[model samples]
Target: PSVQDCTICMERLSAPSGYKGPQPAVKPDLVGKLVKCGHVFHLHCLVAMYNNGNKDGSLQCPTCKTIYGVKTGTQPPGKMEYHIIPHALPGHSDCKTIRIIYNIPPGVQGPEHPNPGKSFTARGFPRHCYLPDSEKGRKVLKLLLVAWDRRLIFAIGTSSTTGESDTVIWNEIHHKTEFGSNLTGHGYPDINYLDNVLAELAAQGITEESLAQEKD
Candidate 1:
């Protein structure tokens, strides 16, 4: 009798010994069900095969074959991340906000642009760089971001820290600049500046989870 081919696609696995780790024995009823082969193939492997050429239902499985499912192409989900340093001033509620402004075109102000003026509406989680009513904490936050990421720093409110860059008084900077941002329309500052900042965060693997509240 001719040997039957394993439905599971194991061609990708170069080594055959103990292949795909320890896969559970296939169920007897699953035999000849057109299952996918691999070091470790899932039951759903068959679904992909069933729908491979399907326009309406494009999915197939290694076993039981040709599962009817809708075609799903990869799509990018646009998201921005940031940490918030809440109001540094007392009795003031600094609406935590983060913005992602583009260096070029369509400006981030087309109603949906994550501009800093309304930082609260930007993202649900903003990192508190420094605690309110604490001089030491604010200094610490300023130091942390600047020291760790090599990012230039600035701030709004009624204080200043003499970093390599001047402690830009936000209001004064605002009056001088186009957005009254003095720094960049609040936290916006220079387009290149923000782009670099966000890029730095990306490099550090700053994801949605980075916005969690600090436990101090």
Candidate 2:
């Protein structure tokens, strides 16, 4: 195969690794291809990439973002509860409401965090998230359940809004938490939220396609 520069270090694939980042002590001078995606990366560069990551026993291809293992999250200990409520939302009065409650407490970072020994704050505990009971909403709910099981819902890191370090934060996937009012920009009457979230889930490699591959 033709040689290409390593994505991590910008060094030629045939040359000795030149990564000056935090990595394992023994750096191997070899280029390896991921079996699933067939994306080539320097062994040492791959080592550094994985080492500097969350180390949740998963590796995503740097080029294509194809996940290798079960992608876990840095979400701190929390509680997630969901149930059907009889109340109707603004846009969908025919269907009931699906109430999801998430409760995360403050705690010290674990091995999966950026700073393992640092203490993180849970700004919001028992956060109430909402969903419609429509067919698309139910499909979104199923994918969300998979995301939660993989710990992809929430993560431990700096808050983007508050700029506070070492705190519980939401990941890329968005949730509609508000019920009746759209005042918080997270309420009902969002006709496209369910489809949008499904797209987000697919971006995170949590779609039905990935699930089918796993089953195979």
Worst 10 residues of 1 by lDDT: 167-176
Cα error of candidate 2 at position 53, Å: 1.9
Q: Estimate each model's TM-score.
A: 0.18, 0.86
Tens-digit lDDT track of model 2 for 61-150: 988888887777767777788999998888999999888888888989988787888888898778988888888778887788778877
Candidate 1 C-alpha lDDT tens digits along 46-71: 33334333233444343443332322
Candidate 2 TM-score, C-alpha based? 0.86
The alpha-carbon lDDT assigned to residue 216 of candidate 2 equals 91
Please give the distance, in angstroms, between residue 212's alpha carbon in candidate 2 and its true position after superposition. 7.0
Q: Which runs in model 1 stand beyond 4 Å of their true positions?
A: 10-29, 32-58, 61-67, 78-216
Scored against the true structure, residue 191 in model 1 reaches a CA lDDT of 32
